[model samples]
Target: MTTDAIASSFAQYVTESPTAFHAAAVARDQLVAAGFTELSELDAWPTEAGAYVVVRDGAVIAWRLPESATATTPFRILGAHTDSPGFRIKPNPGVRTGGWEQLNVEVYGGALLSTWFDRDLRIAGRVVDADGAVRLVSTDAVARIPNLAIHLDRGVNDGKEIDRQRHTLPVVGIDAAFGGTDVLDWLRGRVGEAVSWDLFLADTQAPARIGIDGAFLASGRMDNLTSVHAGLRGIIEAPADGDHVPVFAAFDHEEIGSSTPSGAGGPFLEDVLGRVQEGLGATRSEAARAFRASWLLSSDAGHLVHPNQPEKHDPTNRPRPGAGPLLKISANQRYMTEAKGEAVWAAACDAAGVTWQPFVNVNTIPGGSTIGPIAATRLGIPTIDIGVGLLSMHSVRELVHVDDLAALHGAVAAFLAG
Candidate 1:
C-alpha cells in the first residue's frame, strides 16, 4: 500500500480504538473480513486447514494454517498491545465540590499529565448492562479538566507538579445534583439505557495529518495502536501458504505490566498456541521443538530523536522517523531484541527492501518495556522488539512520520511471509 493509504488506515484505527477492548473488536472485524473464523476458547478444535481467531476479553490471536501444516510446524507470531496510558473512570466517579460536578478517575499508566489539561475529552469503553449485554460506547466531549489559570498560580510558567488524585479531576458541569449518579446517568443517556461499566477518558480530537506537507501523523493511542494496526495489516496482506504458520496476537494491559488474564503475561497466547499444536496431534516434546524454531516480533512504538531534547536519547543509536522501523535494544533486557533476533529482523528488512535504525536509551535514562520480553520469557521463543519511531509518546496526542508506517508495514509483511 502507498504511504498515504497506510497512514489513513492507521488514523482510522486509532480514531475508532480508544480502549483495549475496542481495539480487539476492530482487529476481530478485520480478521473476519479476511475469512478467518472466530473460535471460542471453550469449543473443541478441528483438525483442519483454515484461518481462525480466538479472543479473550481485549486480547485476540489470529492464525492461518495451511493444509501441509503438521504438529511440528514452527509458528511466526506478530505481537502488539492494545492498551495505552490514559485515565479510567472510577467505579463511583461522581463528586460535587464548590457547586461544580466532576468525575473521579484513576490514572492507568505513565501518562503525560500536563498535556491532558484544557483539552476536549470524552469517555469510551465497554459497558455491561443489567441484562448481561456488553456495549461499546464512544461519546463526544462531555467533560474537561481545566487547568488553574496563570492568575491563580503565577509560578505555573515554572515547572509545576500535579497530584494525580487532587489536581486531575475533570470538571463535568455546574449541577450540584451530579454527586451520586450523575456520570452514570450521562453515560446511560448516551448508551440508551442504564448500565454498569468501566469507562476511560480520551481526547475527542480526531487524528490528523500534520506538518507542512502532511508528512506527520498526529493522534492519540499511537504508541501501541500504530503497531497493532501495522501488524494486523501486514499479517492480512502476507502470503499465507508458507510452511511456518503465521499468527497475529494482540494482547491487552501492557501499559500496566501486562498481568491480567488477557495480557501477554497471562495464558492467552500459550493456551491458543497449545490448542493449535494439540489439534495437530503434537506431543509436548514436539511442541517444544516447534517453539525452539519459532520467532516473534513484539511490535510497539519507539522514541524518535527529539530535536528539543536530543540529550535524552543515546547519541550513537538515535532513531529518526522515515528512517525505517526502529529495532529497540537494551543491554538491561528491557527489550527482547538480542543479537540472534536482530539478525532475523535485519534479514526481513533486507527482503522487504527497507532500511532500519536502532534505538537504545541513554545510560542515565531508564526505558520502558513491552510484551516482547514478557512473551519471549513465557514461551521461550526468540523475539525482537520492533516499532516505528514517534514523538510525544503517552501524551494526549503523538506524532510520527507518515511514511514510517508504510516502511513498518513492509518489514512486518516480509517477516511474516519469510
Candidate 2:
C-alpha cells in the first residue's frame, strides 16, 4: 500500500482511459490478470467463489466472491460509472471548411466546454466491425480540440453560448485536412484499418503529479474514471474474508440520463444480480430477499470547493482536496443517501484512516446528479453516494489531491472487504 505505487497506478489509469469502452477494457484486463474470472452477461455463471467480470454494451461490473454464501449474507456492492461528458461523434459527422478537417461532435454530458478549447485532442473507443468483432482504437498525438481565435469571437469574452452543434468542433487535420471523400477512410486508418466504429475525441495527455508538494493530479476524465479505477482496485483488492461478497459495477450512458440498455436505468445490473444469486444456488425469492437486505455505495467524483469561487459552496459542508472522500448530499435527493446510510459508510472511512467531507450544493441554483438513487430505487437496496473531491469536473483536464487517489481506493477497497 505505497502512495507512489497508487500514484503510478492512477497515472496509468488516466493514460489508458479516454473512453468508457477503453476504460472498461483496461479494468477488464486488470481484473482478469489479477485472477478474476470473466463472466458473460449472455451466459451462465460458474457456481463457486471466485472473481468475475461482466460487460453489457460499454458498461462493466466486476467482483470477488465470498468464500461461501448464504441467503442472509447480503452482497456488498460498489457502483461507479465509466462515462464522462465529452464530444461524441455523430453519424456522418465529417465536415470540411477553410482547408481544415473536422468531425461534427455533440457534447454528451454537462461538460465544462470552455476548458476543452486549445487542448490536445485524440480519439479512442471501441470499433465494432461488420464481422461483429469489437476492437479498441485510439490516436494519441496532436489530440487536441482547437478553439476559435479570440479575435474571431470577441463576444466570447462577454456572455455568449457557443452552439455545440454549429461551432466548437475540433480541427483534426492540418490545412486541407478534409480535401476529399477519403476522409472516412483516413479516419478508419488512424484508428483501426477497415474498422467501422464509434470514436470520440480525447486528450492524449497522461496523468501526472503537479504543484510544489506534488499534491495535485492533472488528468482528463477524472470525474467517473477515478471512481472506475478505484472501484476496479477495490474489486481486485477485496480480502479473503468469508463474510461478504464484494461487487463493482461501471455502466455507460450515465452522462446522458442513463436511459440506455447498458445504463443504470436498464436491466444490465438486474440481469447480472439475478445470475449472481442463481449461480450461488439461491432461489428467486431468496435472491429478491438478498437484494432487499444488501447495501450499495454509488461512487462518483464530488466537487471540491473551488478556490476562485468558494462562495458557491455551503460554508460548513464544503469538501477540500486532500481532505478525503466527499459525502454527497442533496435536499432534492439527487444523491441516494440519508443520515443512516451516510453513517454506515462514514464508519468505513474512519476505519480506513480516510478523512471525509460533506457536499450539499448551494441552494436554488440546482446541482448535477449521480447513478445512486437511480439504482437503489430500481433494486430496492439501501444506497449511499460518495467520492473524491475534484476541481474542474467535466473539464478536459481536471485536478485533485495526489494522496486522495489512494485514500479513495483505500476507502472503497476497505468497504468492500467489510
Candidate 3:
C-alpha cells in the first residue's frame, strides 16, 4: 500500500480501538476478514498449513504456517502491545463534588497527565454481565478534565504541577438533582447491568493527519498501536511459502511492566507456540529446538530527537521522524537488541529496501523499557527491539511521521518473511 493509504488505515484503526480489548477485537475482526480462521484456546488447533488467529482477553496472536513447515520449524515473530498509558476507571466511580458530577480514576501507567486535561474523554473497555459473558463497550464523548483557569492560578504558566488524586477527576456532568449521576447506572443503561468491569478512560478525538503537507499523523495510543497496526498489516500481507512460521503477537499491559496473563512477560506466546508444536506432533525436545532457532522482533514506539529538547537524546545516535524506523538500543538491557539482532534487523531492512536509524537515550537520562527484554527473558528467544519514531510519546495524543510508519510496515513484513 502507498504511504497515504497506510496512514489512512492506521487512523481508522486507532479511531476504532479505544482500549486494549477493543484493539484486540478489532485485530481479530480484521484477521478473520483477511481469510484467517479464528481459533479458540479450548479447542484443538489444526496443524495443516494455513492462517489462524487466537485472542486471549486483551491479547491476540496470529500465525501463518507454511506447507513445508515442520514441528521444529523456527518462527519469525513480530511482537507489540495493545495497551497505552492512561487512566482506568475506579470502582464506585461516581462522585458528586460541589455541583459537578465526576468520575474517579486511577492512573494506569506513565502517562503525561497534563496532556489529558480539557480533552473529550470516553469510557471504554470490557464489561462482564451477570451471565458471565464479556462485552466490549465504549461511550461517546462524555467527560473532560478541565484545567484550572489562568485567572484562578496566575502561576500556572510558570510550571503547573498536577495533583493526580486531587486534580485528575474527570467531570462527567452536573449534579442538578443534588445526588450523584450514578455512572454505573448510566453504563448499565448502555451495556446492561454489569457485575464487574475493567474500564478505562479514552480520548474520544479521531486520529488525523496534521502538519503542513500532511507529513505527520496525530492520534491516541500511537506509542504502541503504530507497531500493532504495522505488525497486523505485515502478517496479513506475508507470504505463507516462507520456510519459517510467521507470527504476530500483540499483548496487553506493557505500559505497566507486562506481568499480567495477557502481557508479554507471561506464557501466552509460549503457550500458543507449544500448542502449535503439539499440533504438529513435535516432541518436547523438538519444541525446545524450535524455540532456540526462533527470532522475535519486539516492536514498540521509540522517541525521536525532540527539536526543542535535543539534549535529551544521544548526540551521535539521534533518530528523527520521517527518516525511517528506529533500532532501539540501551546499555542496561532495557532494550533486547544486540549485535546479532542488529545484523538481523539490518538484513531485513535491506531486503525491504527500507532505511532505519538507531535510537539511544542520552547518558544522563534514563530510558524506559519495552517488552523486548521481558519477552526475551521469558521465552529465551533471540529478540531485537525496533519501532517507528514518534514525538510527544506517552501524551494523550502522539505524533509520528507518515513515512516512518509506512517504512515500519515494510520492515516488519520483511522480517516476518524471513
Tell me the whole-model lDDT of each prediction, alpha carbons only. Answer: 0.89, 0.81, 0.93
Q: Give the best candidate by TM-score.
A: 3
Instruction: Please give, for residues 129-168, the per-residue lDDT of candidate 3 as tens digits.
Output: 8999999999899999989999999999999888999999
The list of candidate 2 runs beyond 4 A from truth reads 142-144, 174-181, 191-195
The most accurate candidate by lDDT is 3
TM-score of 3: 0.98
Please provide TM-scores, in order, for all candidate models, with all chains considered together.
0.97, 0.95, 0.98
On TM-score, who's better, 1 or 3?
Answer: 3
Q: Give me the displacement of residue 274 in model 2, in angstroms.
A: 0.6
lDDT of 2 by residue, 1-418 (tens): 6777887887888788888888888889898899988777666678677778877767898877777776556878889898888888877766777787677788888888888888878777778776788888887664356667879888877877867776678776644443444446667676555446777878877887899988898988898888888888888878755576788999998889988888998888888777777777788788878877788999999898888998988878878778888888887889988998888888888878888888888885588888998898789888999988899888888998977888898889878888
- For candidate 1, write residues 1-418 as lDDT tens digits: 8899998888889888989889999999988999889888888977699888887888888888888888899998899999999899997787778777898999999999999999999989888878888888898887898899999999999989999999999988765563444665676688776467778999989999988888999999998898889789877876668989999999999999998899999999999999999999999999999999999999999999999999998978989877998999998899989999999999999998999999999999888999999999899999999999989999999999987888988899889897
Clashing pairs in 3: none
**What TM-score quantifies how close candidate 1 is to the native fold?**
0.97
Can you rank all candidates by TM-score, best first? Answer: 3, 1, 2
Which 10 successive residues of model 2 have the least lDDT summed? Answer: 174-183
Better candidate by lDDT, 1 or 2 = 1
Tell me the lDDT of model 3 at 256.
97
